[model samples]
Target chain A: MSRLAIHGRDLLLDRSARGPSWLVPSLEVSRGERIALCGPSGSGKSTLLSAFAGRLAARRGSLQVEGCELVGASEAVRRAHRLATMGQALQDAEMISYLSTVDNVLLPLRLAGRPVGAAQRARAHDLLARLGLSDRQHSRPSQLSHGERARVAIARALIAAPPLLLIDEPTASLDPASREAALDLLFSAEGTVVFATHDPGLIARVDRAFDASIWREP
Target chain B: MIVWHAAALACKGLAATPIRAVVVVFGLALAMGLPGMTVRTASHIEAVMVERAVRTPVLIAPRGSPFEVTLASLYFRGEAEPRVPFFVAAQAVTRGYGSAVPVLVGYRASGHPLVGTSADYFEARGLRPVQGRLPAVLGEVVVGAGLAAQAGIAVGDRLRSDRVRPYDLGTSQPVELRVVGVLGWSASPDDEVVHADLLTLRAIEGILHAHEPAGSEAAPGLGASVFLPVDLSPETLDRVHAHGALEELPVTAVLVFPPDDRRRDQALGDWADHPELQAVQPERVVSVLVELLVRVRDLLLAWSMIVSGCTLALIALVLALWRRLRERELALLRTLGASRSWIALLVAIEAGLLLGVALSLAAGFAWVAPVLLLGALG
Candidate 1:
């Protein structure tokens, strides 16, 4: 057993009656692998990332993450599995705008019905400090700069310390130096990382790369 | 515990939109306050009306509408009924059943009704003179506490009754009466009356006037005064007293107090079949009026309830629309691993808090409304 992080075969995702479909004949990723999904706009990169995160179901395929079947599984089972084993930073940076930075970071555990005790508070503070946002912990999301907001989103995704991490365009709005810094933090995180992006610089840092254009229908 | 967390989050969400939250809270307050204030005022009015009626035991008047007779006698409201002969009081007193006090209305002094009765009326009403003394002679009158303060009349001041048909050349003269005393406050219509003896009221009504002396300045058309002599000479008093007769005197109603329940029943039976008279229990007539008032209150209450129900429904619709607008925020929470039931609980908690604060404000308004209304009226 290679302890596969993700395994999919003959995956098909249809968009609309007249829209394009995403097709994957076969795909496999091993544990602790750093994989990048490289593509242009509307190349089905985000759709593929959504499928891997269990946010979207494959129309026809056997897809499994850490040996838990995703295809045809109930929504509740998929949601529980996602919450327990995966950390995802969505493309929209869906930070609760009213919550302070520190509370946003603690949201994952709170949502999971876990007690945010003293140790949890300490961990959240440490994560904010590591992301260079210790001074802005009490600032609301609206008060944060675009790059700071991106970093906060990253910190929130990593707070639960799940074994599998999925990120979508985490550095899309960052300056060159900030983008490099965010990428440094993402690559240095402890997990089997799967990210979707159009940046070749981010793709070059990954151990494996998949071109989403291959499966995108015209 | 989870609900508490949900409520805390809901509060934060509401606080984010301060103006919308305020609108919702005040809408609920008005919805609740309108009905609350109406019910409170109705209760006060009913209580006051019934209590005043209960104090007067019986009323004897000319054959007419019992409601009008009771209202005129006890509350001093509505048109004065046809006058009953003053001999009715003498008949009741001579029958050895109860004391009868005559009430004569139809005269006004400074917009206050000038009521004429005997000194026994004061004793029956448990009123005492806070100033001089009760009216003991024909030309003297006693003012109620409220009238004394309102009209700014004190002891030894002469107050003129308003002349009936003042513009008519043939109308009788207005009579002047001296204020002998001021009665204590009783918190009833009695406190607003200018009280006098029956002879004085007759003089004010122009039933009695001073005799003009021969070859004097008091000729009928020689710049004759509009007022009769208030301080009559002994000769004039003698002439006026000789002409006055008990059979011709009129009273609006006779307030009778039977010595016991047996005598009260006898008095009721004795007058029940009389062709020209009707004796009524003032309390019974007032109860009927209170029943009508209660029906009106119930109708008002039902209307208020419908308004309140509509307001609550409106609030619910607003909340539902707010929930629809917040779908994205809720979906984000779901993506963050919050359960569906937890989200529902959050919305419920927010609504409950808003209604709770609104209901409290309505209760406070209801408590204060009656006091303010009664104070203004009093």
Candidate 2:
């Protein structure tokens, strides 16, 4: 069985004529793998994650996620594929202040036009409990501690059990203990994780690391 | 189902800032409701005034504004309007032109107008007693059904007239009236007054009184010297008399119901040359008044439309600012894979719900405000 999660060749980032840009010559990720895109602050790590999520088009590439082409795909097609195959747990970006913790978890299903029935609610509760947020599931984002909010974002990304997860700086503003807990919960999710991170400890904990600084245009 | 889900989400978002939502809703409701209520209330007044005027063929009033005379006679308003002598009505009646019912208004019984008229006034107004017989004896009156209900008066109840100027020692004291009957509802001005014989009301006014006991000579003006006897025994009834001729006494106006167009024309012509009175076709006068009112209403309607436009623009501005504030939240929705149409639909649903509630509130208030206004007017 072919279980490829992401594939790319000549993946371009921010293709502007007179602006900073980069190109990833080749890349591949398998289902259930934990890979870190390691680089400095301006090394296009976040840009590559955005590209994998189909948020923006690449200038020239053969890019695919779970056998679906993304580089030249239409917006509708990209959206459907992304919703079906990927989940995101960006740092502080997915925390909608108006929604409660559990509602935020169920947001993905709502966006996908799927009914959030009893089973779905039970699954969300189970996921939140696994992430050690059972007591804070109904709390608004503003009422949550920073560490608790990060764990909630992870639970939201895992709620749909997508085959691929994209994360940006999951442990950016946390103490050592909170960082460890957040990584523990994230690593437990049943999907391939392609995360951008600057933490050396996290870089060492992942299954493999790709240095994105090598792909810089300079 | 998806639309309902979007609406629910929209509701949740609006609930996040309840004060803004409430302000927007009430502002919209008032903006939409005020004009509609004013138009409806004005139209209701016009319909009532025009209907009454169309029924009374001719009105004989002291030379003054015919509009004020019509208002005084038909609606019991214009208390300061000039009064025509009672002889004008009596002459019209005796000449066989048509029926003439003299009305002596401007007095009140328990805060309701005291309409002093005769049995012919009752017949001409198509008023029938619902509880008891029409007023027949001195010091007796028939109350309008609405007034009876509001004042908690019933047949046989004694209602004292409100003193016109209680502070003035020269004015007559209030006379206690016996409620002999309750007139049925006519949905007209007649339903809010106390009906009595013109002579009985004059007695209350100190114009007529019990004659000074045998040779104590009739005093000048009959002024408060003899308060109307509380109980009108047959002896006292016969003794009550005015010092001057009854024909010269004031009746606010005379409502003439001419049987046909020819008599109406004759009634108009008869008063054309009169020195102190003027005859008017109330229908024509009411038409001119209503036209003036309609013009004023049109101007008000235009003004209200401008106000409503401003209100709508304000609403749009508020919504725009609100949506701009929620741009981050909406972007999160977009990141969750919602389409542009989906986000647009959510915002639209929120605004649509607000407008719908405002429209419903405005309609309900518009429907009820006019009736309350007309009731207050009466």
Give the per-residue lDDT digits (tens) of candidate 1, residues B1-378.
676567767788888888888989988887889788879878987887787777667788888778887887787777675478899888988986588999987778756788888988998889999999998877788998877886788998877778766785353556667788999988677877889888777776566666555445665455443444444433356655325586557789999988788988888888999998888888898888989988998998899889988998898798789888888778877775576676778878888888898888889878787766764664
Best by lDDT: 2
Per-model TM-score on C-alpha atoms:
0.70, 0.86
CAPRI verdict (incorrect, acceptable, medium, high) for model 1? acceptable
Q: Give every collision pair in model 2.
A: none
- By DockQ, the best candidate is 2
What tier of docking accuracy does candidate 2 attain? acceptable
lDDT of 2 by residue, A72-127 (tens): 99877887788888888876655777778888898888777778889999999988
